[model samples]
Target: MDTITTYLDSLFASLPDNDKTRQAKADMLANMRDYYRDLLREGKSEEAAIGAVISAFGSIDELRADLGMPAQATATTTQSDPTDAEEEADEDAITETELRSFWHMADQFATQIALGVLLCAVSIALPAYTGGGRWEGFGVIGMFLLAALAVGLFIWGGTVFSQQKKQLNDRPITASAKQLANKTTGEYTRQFAAGLIAGIMICIGSLIPPIISAYIPGFIIENAGGALFLAIAGLGSYLIIYVSINYSQLKRYAYATTAANSTAWYHDGTDDDAANYWEQPHKHHQNTRARQDIALFHQVYWPTVLIIYLLVSFLLHGWAYSWLIFIIGGVMQNIITAVIARRDYSE
Candidate 1:
């Protein structure tokens, strides 16, 4: 439905906004929706139905004449004598430098968040390593102290990142990294793959210490195993979160089209693949909606998981592999988001 609306917007963009035009536009949209539903009833795929609707839209120029409006000016005339308004719009478009400076900080922000989480995990182990009895109090105090420091890092990093996003914002991403940086799409894809593999490996390995400790038969084995598991799991999470968050934003910009974002640094018409160009606007819409939904989930989910983790780790005296809770939570979050996105956008 959004894709249909977006296409309708493009078809009517040049027309004046008034009572008759609005009525016509609404009628056109209704007709398009009816055709779309008929195609669906005939078992056509959503993509095929949308394509058919757009292909049959014919010429907006004819509609303009019917609406008592003048025909569009020739491209040659507009190109030869572009208006001041057009020049001002071009000037107002976001610069690549501003984009690079602002968006490239995702990695930094991810690192800060991951490191803070890792520190909290490490803080849990301090009490175990410091021994039992009265000395455990000191270790517990140290745990809180480290946790406090980790919280401070989180606050500071989040503040800076939020402020940057709020202040440096402009148009959405409009071009691939090739237009802004030296890296290619293949490079980023490879990087994402490598990071994913590494995170999985680390997470898998985190199970090793606890498994071995179970058979070793020693008192400290449990605490040591738990500490090791937490640390390793935290490290794995850092890699996954760091790469996923940064790569997500990077990708949104990389494949964005001029129709999706106003800041088209180097979009000339024939350069981009025709199919890719047509897909961009819809992809942009899907990504924006999915990102918002996932972000809202993150706000509630991760903090709650952290609180649960802290209570469990503290109460259980460093339960071996307790930190696996985090890894599992992340996996669940990913699966949930993936399912939601597929179900929501599949139509």
Candidate 2:
């Protein structure tokens, strides 16, 4: 099958790439596959079946003549009629298979990242559970394990995105493909809205325990309430991320993959800034790397801060001052966001 595909590619290498020619190539490949299968069913050797299929196709010219496709034009095409040139450029456009693979990878990446965040947020509260004395050791171990998992997820998801972007950088997105991706997300809109609302409510409701504990004296719900706050916030973040996936920008990304290479795409002088959004391998990689850096900081910084805060507040009995660390961490996070934006994608 691979050999047949290679042969077909070589045969049509010089032909004008347009809808009719694409249809013809598809038909030819199908016919070749059917013939090869028939030969195999008739007890022909694999080599013989392949050789017969190749011989049956004859030359490229013969194939073109048979398919009623015009012969490859030798003359330089004028700029006045850009249709043929535009059609030709779409030969290396993104296919349905690649798009599906991207979406699948994206979904996996999102779930892993969200889970990582959840684990990080919950790790600090593990010591408060299953008794306090020696189980604190268990909490430390749990925090280490969860942090390890979160780092691993960050690396995996970042690598997945970077590699996918590399493979798809030089491809264009077709109108049909764009529409299909848009429709796919559009179908889930109502569900996403409901889920979004529910997640926010869950986050808001997490504070109920603390508020109730203020009124009813002896329950001792401080740790539980704090843990609930982190857990619910993390869950709400996961919900927002999972539902807010912007699949439509995939088309723009596909085009931007090779925007730096002038020969790679036809500019035709329209909306140049928008067309040059992330600028191919170099700048695209910078943005991707920037994101990885930001994620790493979040994965490491906040969790470590939370662990310190929990230890000081619970064990050392420094709840009054330890809460200040969060404010510092939040400010640092905002700094990271700003730095990445300026360095990678400013104006």
Candidate 3:
């Protein structure tokens, strides 16, 4: 009964915690307990009784609706077959740490993309507003202000990423699980075509300002430049949104084997059977090292780049060219990464 309660808790843990939700969960749990006990009195084994009780318990969506809660896509899914439903229920179980990791990734990408757009827009707007009396020196001040904000946001995002990694690593997944199947090549190809079409639409939408400017004259061209900056930012935001949506969709593909069935007790004794279920050799080591190296590079590289941009902008008073340093740094980082990967692969 304790194990069953724990399992139910895991299922609902991702939802928002509140009084009504809590009471609804408690009610459902009590009903399940009653059903479980009834099955036990019918002369069933403990395992079968528990399984039957769980199987009889319906989807949480209807319950959530009755509780006046919004529909949640992350809620436990259902299947027609009892066995498959049980398997899916077990697989979809996720810890709060795992959910936090997904949210962090989404938030980091969104923040970074917004910052990129803001920096680009300010770069355009500052120069356009500079020739006036009141704003003569404001360009430099505004640029520095935006740069500081960007740095703070970058640091916060980095911290979130670090916290997510630490939390996930500290609590390892020991559940003996069946690895979920990846999407087929055909599915990926279809998605790629759809994404490309979406990207084209985004580009077309972004070019609307320039298209409009072509019909107008004079000072409007400068306005068109600002529009272009916005368009670039929009494009970036679009890509991030696309990536995040895809990531969320992909999460459904991964299912974890429940702890209750991590290992088969009736398996024939063998040396190979003693190996840990989650263990992978070379690929695991390589992936871990890759993630660590990438994280380290981002932590060091961005802060160093931000510092250099600030120094150059303030000392040389070259706001126009100083931003190019970021582009150059990005290219260099890619080159260095490629070279290191090649060297590592060779060894």
lDDT by residue (tens digit), candidate 1, 58-125: 45664553344443323332243222323323343444565677666767887888788888878887
How does residue 265 of candidate 2 score in lDDT? 28
Per-residue lDDT of candidate 3, residues 1-347 (tens digit): 98779878975786678765566567667656765675576588999987866655544553343333443212342113334433433343433335445554755655574465456556555545564556657766776776677667667766765665454342222232223213322344466446545644664465555556676656357554554645454454445344433443233222222222222121122223212211222222333444456677778988999999999999999574465566446535644654554443332
lDDT of 2 by residue, 69-140 (tens): 433321232232343443544566554566778877777776786677677666755654423566668877
lDDT of each: 0.64, 0.58, 0.49
Off by over 4 Å in 2: 1-89, 128-134, 246-347
Q: Runs in model 1 with CA error above 4 Å?
A: 1-94, 133-138, 168-170, 176-186, 218-222, 254-323, 331-347
Summed over model 2, clashes come to: 0
Ranking by lDDT: 1, 2, 3
Q: State every prediction's TM-score relative to the real structure.
A: 0.59, 0.48, 0.39
The stretch of ten residues in a row with the least summed lDDT in candidate 2 is 269-278
What residue pairs clash in candidate 2, if any at all?
Answer: none
Error of 2 at 116 (Å): 0.6
Q: Which candidate leads the pack in TM-score?
A: 1
